[model samples]
Target chain A: MKEPLLPALKMTLLTLVLFSGVYTLAVWGIAQLAPNGGEGEIITHNGKTYYENVGQQFTEDRYFWSRPSAVDYNAAGSGGSNKAASNPDYVATVQARIDSFLVHNPGVSKAEIPVDIVTASGSGLDPHISPKAAQLQVQRIARVRNLPLEKVQALVAEHTEKPLLGFLGPERVHVLKLNIALDNLK
Target chain B: MNTEILGVIAIYILIVLLALPLGKYIAKVFAGERTWLDPVFNPLERLFFKLSGIDPTLEMNWKHHLAALLGINLLWFLLAMFVLMNQGWLPWNPDGNPSMSPHLAFNTAVSFLVNCNLQHYSGETGMSYLGQVFCLMFLQFVTAGTGMAAAAAVFNAMRERSATHFGNFYNYFLKSCTRILLPVAFVAAIVLAFSGTPMTFEGKDSMITMQGDTVQVSRGPVAAFVAIKQAGTNGGGFYGVNSAHPLENPDYLTNAVENILILIIPIAMVFALGFYLNRRKLAWMIFGVMTLGFLLLSLPSIYSEMQPSPIANQLGIDGSAGNMEGKETRLGAAASAFWGISTTATSNGSVNSMHDSHTPLSGAMQLIDMMINSLYGGVGVGFLNFYIFIILAVFISGLMVGRTPEFLGKKVEAREMKIALIIALLHPFIILVGTALSAFIFYHNPEIGWLNNPGNHGFSEMLYEYTSAAANNGSGFEGLGDNTPWWNISTGFVLLLGRYLPIIGPVAIAGILANKKYIPESAGTLKTDTGTFGLMVFAVIFLVAALAFFPALALGPLAEYFNH
Candidate 1:
């Protein structure tokens, strides 16, 4: 043990420099070629810059809502509500989300609410909702913005992203981008 | 039936297929055979040994290997503590995250050093970029190398020959990092970066939402951090929510990559043993049992998660979308459940969804997988833990057959059995005892505010913390609010013991077995690498590890499951 200690100290330093210093910088160099320089996909619209990947709060009646966030879409940090699936209080919170949705979109029934829209996402930063999740909320967006229902539905369809290779991921819509498109409509 | 399930199935198939060759490669790397990577890594490794003033050719017994492992680990721990404690003052702390509290630092340092990586603090606010790279990510690589090196030494001992010296620890350690972990992580990191995962040194970026609110989006060298974190079977998150964070795991492709990365080496090491021992059948048999165990745990969790949870019905909410309380819409419920089991089984505890929010049955399966670990397990130690179970099975079956037990023609004596038994029992002892104390405190002082949810689920939270600690499986019930001194110090001890004891006990047993006279195989000797023997090993794991946790599990997840 004593004989190995001197070497251990040196090897620790050597590997530390190799992994944390050189390897990290090497990866950083590779990331330089990535879109948006790997600082997250930032898009500017109407003179405002927003990260396309990170979820944002979208509670206004005139826009499609993102999933409920435990941290209120606090991107400086991220987390889930972590409410137990069977906890009554957690169930009540989901109930409240549903009731609120029904109030804002009076034409929708309880069964029509997609669970993704009511339950909190794991990251508290889920930018996308299921395409169905986006579809169900279209009527409200149409009513609030005074647009025809077909026009709002078409906007949702236009913004919907296909699964990777059409089978590798889920079909979903980025709420921020879709809402932006709705705002830009003439 | 959906495309999401296909994505999960694809990663499962991809990793096993990839692990087959990786295992052979790993065996070659440790056995000192020539490989394609040698031209690149040989000179680099030589330079490392020369600068460290270490002779990589000195073969020592298991004691020396253990000493070498512990000695370097101690130094690494101190270095990690220094970095974490001073991370605020360290360079590249762009978020202005403060140095960790003394208790948090101790817990964080010990947790990562042991390869458990039970994070008590959120990464965005709790850690500096220096801390992310130096303190945590560095440990992810080295600790995995340490586990692989220890297993490699054990492999040398298991070779059907009498010997005192096994192999050089530093050589295997260096080879594992250079020839295995580093190259794979480099490629995976690039994949992650290209798929929208962030890899930058900059601080948080202020973004204006379309709704007129400014939000701070945290950014760092996360792709690189996440790559090693998963590939090393070190599940520490670069951000507070782990892979759930969009920047850490940006999409389904990156999620699949991360999942595939975590399982590859662990499953591959089983095959490495087969190659190392020149027994492909044994590797297949072991892989078979592990896969059966994995399916038994995972399929149920997936089914449970996909069902509309009773809570949804009770609250009159729509049940068609399954339980989505803490799952991402892009990944969906089935994929998250699959990940929950995969992460716990591998001891790579990064989550794409919150385990605390999983339905009762799925949550139970996660705990059960950790408690009865060694189902394709974590890094090298996963096999080590399973090796202990193998010895116990050999001894128990020997008793049934009324013949002295021998593994690979080496006699399994009383000494070996005692060591295996103790190692087998230590995991449960730490987890159960620690939970009892924490639960006692929680019940006595309900206002401590440790639990975010009440009743059975809260108890499940306490149980999950200790189980995660003792199993060296570091996913948590995130709502536990467990950064207080009691949770931190107690789990710190569990993490240390849970890690070293399993490594020490098995290697010591293997070392003893290696010193014994090699007995020739006979009809009287019980065959270890057979299907019947695999069943016996599974039974032993069930009887020993799984049964001990039944009562505690019942009180938590089982009770929750049966209610309503």
Candidate 2:
């Protein structure tokens, strides 16, 4: 192994410069023009900056809910519940969420709940929910905000993102963007 | 048809379409043939060689190549250790993260250095800017380039020509970086940066959520790190949650691109082998076997995950959206399930969904993929794994046919046979033993704090860790609270053994076979590239892997699956 030590050392040093120094500078330079200057796309509202992508906690009836987060939407760090699909504790947690949803919205039945509303997202910071999930909460938001049911439904329709190329991915709605739109509703 | 299923199909089609041209380019780069990139990279490569005072064209044998590989890797380990252990006070420590403990540093440094990024330490709080960029990200490029160089050396020896010299490792390594990895990574990084994967030096930003909770959102030079992490099959994440973090994989479109990045290099490497040896049929045969193995594991996972999660089903909550536990709605369960199989198949461990939280059947698929890891495999090492199986297949077939076992016209003697069998058996031996030891310790002591889930699922966590470490497929059941010294140190040893030995074994066998006199093909000679031989190799792989791993799998994922 020592046979190539001299050359290996010199090679390693040069690669450090090539990859860490030069290659990084190249990517960093391109990032200068990226959205939000690659700091991450952010939303500036009232006073604070919110990561447009990172999900925020939105359990209030007036707003559409983000997916349940095991880490409770901790953007400082991210994780999942990591509970097995059959873990009893995890099952109970999902049951509690459903019960809470029922209390919050007497109109919606258990069978109407989208699974996204019950499952804790892997990243805990997932900003998007399936369109069905957002729609499930539309009636609750309409009731709490004193807005017409049609108005809230239209709001969900407006924010609902279609799959790529009209048919390649799951259709989802960004919870933060939709809620901000809801708050802006006249 | 399900749009998410279409999305998975589209990604697979794109992978095959993209891999062809990239594979040809990779072959040209290693062959030292001129291409469009030569004008750009030739001067830079010369500059590197000049600075190092090394000859780029120096002919090296197998031993010389191994010496160079180990030599540089050792230095890389030290550099990684120094940076990781001292990231707290490092120049680019924007987040003010603390340094890792000695044992953690040892684990992390060895993990990334060996190209298996089994990160017990999460990226959000554990690493600084300098550590992410210089240490982990830099290792991603070179470790991948290093693996490719080793593959090129093996490819060189296996060529029809009787060459005493294996190709120069530096030539292959430099070209792999500048031509193969750098160009693709640059474009992909730029794409990801625009797609909200952060590429900045900014520290964590504090923001108030809609619910009036103040939270700190961590951002970094993540686009740069993530691009290579996927492309190089390193699978380390800049975030604690890997690709599941919204910033790392912003949306479905970005998710597709990132998923493509994982398989592109690994698949291209298979085609590269074909182009290098001028054996297109042989490469296709191998690719076919790998793809068959991949689909066998993946399709069932996709179907299983498309069903409702146990929680949703037991509660009778409408789960038309499928198993959403630990999965992003943006990626969806079908896409996530497909990704789980693909990532494990390629030794690219980045996850769009949590494997630990997947449906038990899907979880089992992920485990089995890692257990039989040669399906389009890791960056350069995938073919190397398949090569071991091929050697075994040749030996077995020869015994049945009553002829001398040979591959590429070289005799499969006792020395080569012993090495191949050891390499084949070594993967499962380490994984099982490590899992058993951890299981025993947990059973006896029960206070070591390793498992996060309860009962059989907990055992899967332990099993997944050792399998991930030993397979050099670093995706884990993160449910395993594995930041402790026991988890780190044990898996670190497994990671090193898993990566280097498989690589060294194949290269040694190929090197020995290459130096022997080349015999022209005769009517009686075994045709190793035929469909029959491909089936034989596939059988041998399943037989060896299944024999070694079945009991352990039954104990872990399989038991968990049926219990539910």
Candidate 3:
């Protein structure tokens, strides 16, 4: 007589049901531990002001603007402009971004503008800018804070992470933490 | 290449030792001989069969066995998919990783169950403790066992006189997993744990940074899985960093040992074929040819990487240590480069170093291995690919000499030739077609941010990544922006197709051959157990690769090599 297929079918079904039940519980639990959301304030150039997220919408009297996140859906979505560094489109976008920032902070020269300030990130949704880029904005930030450029540069230094494993990836700066340190500087 | 040399020697020794005991155990299990351990598990085995409605006493032919194999695999397919999709809600996830996106889960499920293990998700960050156990670790044994069962079927086909039956798949699968895979995994895991790879619920979150800041140290149930991951040649890393992670890898001694362990079963199975065939010399010839071919192709890249680049020195980036980019200092250049070539060459895609960051010559060698689809491929599968080539070679020679082709008393015919050709060309087709579509269709797509680099070399790197993924060789150059859905789904499609098609091709060929009347061996029969035949087999492999990949590779990695 042919063997019944029902028993094998039952085992397969049981394994699936048990596996699915445990997996869902794990993800829901981790979400609970994460901070409610990132909180911070806005920096102004000229009379206009902008902040990173919706919660941080403000016309702050003192602060420095980090790199613009392309995650701003109305502005740019979750990607870089994708133009090669040498491409005319990339160069043009950088120029346009520089022109907009210069309009806000008029006294800042073309040379004083950081590359991160003008260039889009790989994700374009990068929450942080390069340290070289951060240092360029240090003078402007200091002048606005009525403090020394060295102190502002130190804050950038504090937030920078050297390469992981001393070699795995590029060195990085966490923009959120640096900006938070700026508030703590007072 | 001292590490690779050590690794190769280690594999040779381990394979020789393990094959006899393992093969004998397999033979006994299939023969229904009682062992000391069998009595203890006899009840469990009976219960499992009773529960599955499979009658242990029923004798079946190859067709019925293949059906059972397919059915069980289907069950695994569904189980893996369900586990991956819902990993977010799984238990023991202290860090709270989310469910894999639908497409990624599908890709991963197919990948692991097929023994490809092409992970889009990071084990430490993406999967919880339980998900790792139920999904990845479990699949390791199942997939490896599947490969062993297939090999045993092929062995049975060769051994049986007139009967058309290959063997029972359920019995083979169960015996392979319980008798072979589990024991080896247990021993290797114990050794690896002793070597300091962690095996606990507690995550290795200890932050140790050279620059005196916090770094997220990735750890998981690595020691538990690393054994089978290597032994089965199913090369998924416990963490995204792969074998480069200090905790996952431990130290130099463990690195060498693990690398050797990975190649041991696959290599020894060459000799195991000899044991099964009762022709030890023929297996040696296969082993010799593969080892020689592997070394000849691998050595140049190894030597090239050892030389420090002048440009690197000028930039003050230390190449003195020999191509240290994308490698952990703990493993060093020689060890990392060795692992890179050996793993990919054997169809184990675990990387100690990033292939993308390697010099152009090194990268080309790796691409070449994939071009041949690395015959010495996955564990039991590699020898099978070699055997297919050997049969094809003999068939072609037979036609030339006006004699019927026979290898080990088995006739090579039209049906077998067609299947062999299909299996041989399967990888190159996926690779060439995938590379062309990605490079041509999506080459200038705005979403392809990672391929934004200038010239054909960058395009080749992207091409290579898809080729590797589709072929189930999961080493990435890190430059490919494969995190997107377009790549995840498309590459996953190629992976699924590449894995199953070649396997299905062989099984179908075996089925056809099973029913065929065996032509008696005569003086005119072309013998396969010779160096000349091995060379001919190599040539067949080379010819297939040349016809399929030469043009695409020239356009991609080759162009990049010359351009730089």
Query: Each model's interface RMSD (Å)?
Result: 1.2, 1.0, 13.0
lDDT of each: 0.90, 0.89, 0.62
Error of 1 at B5 (Å): 1.6
lDDT of 2 by residue, A116-182 (tens): 9877899998898888888878778888888899989998999999999999989989889998888
- lDDT (C-alpha) at residue A4 in model 1: 63
Q: What lDDT score goes with residue B380 in model 2?
A: 87
Which clashing pairs does model 1 show? none
Model 1 regions more than 4 Å off:
none
Candidates 1 and 2, the one with greater lDDT: 1
Chain B TM-score, all predictions listed: 0.99, 0.99, 0.92
Q: Which numbered prediction scores highest in DockQ against the true structure?
A: 2
Cα displacement (angstroms), candidate 3, residue B177, comes to: 1.2
Q: Please write out the lDDT profile of model 1 over residues A17-97, one tens digit for every residue.
A: 999999999999989999988888788887888887888899999889998998888799999998986667887788888
Candidates in descending DockQ order:
2, 1, 3
Indicate the residue-level lDDT of B243 in model 3.
67
The residue-by-residue lDDT of candidate 3 on B1-564, one tens digit each, is 243345434544565576556655555655567766786568766766676666656655666756666677777888788878887886677667788888888878877877877776667667776677778767777777777777767766766365677667766666666666665666666656655565545553433221223333344556666777787778887766566554456455667667776666676666667766577677777877787777776777767666653223323322344554344434545556667677777677877666665666777778777666644677666766666677778887777788777765667777788888878777777777777777776656746575644666567667777667755777666556666676777778887777666666666666666666766667766767788877887787788765677787777667766755
DockQ of 1: 0.82
Candidate 2 segments exceeding 4 Å error: A1-3
Q: Score the docking of each candidate (DockQ).
A: 0.82, 0.85, 0.04
> Candidate 2 DockQ score?
0.85
Candidate 2, residue A47: lDDT: 79
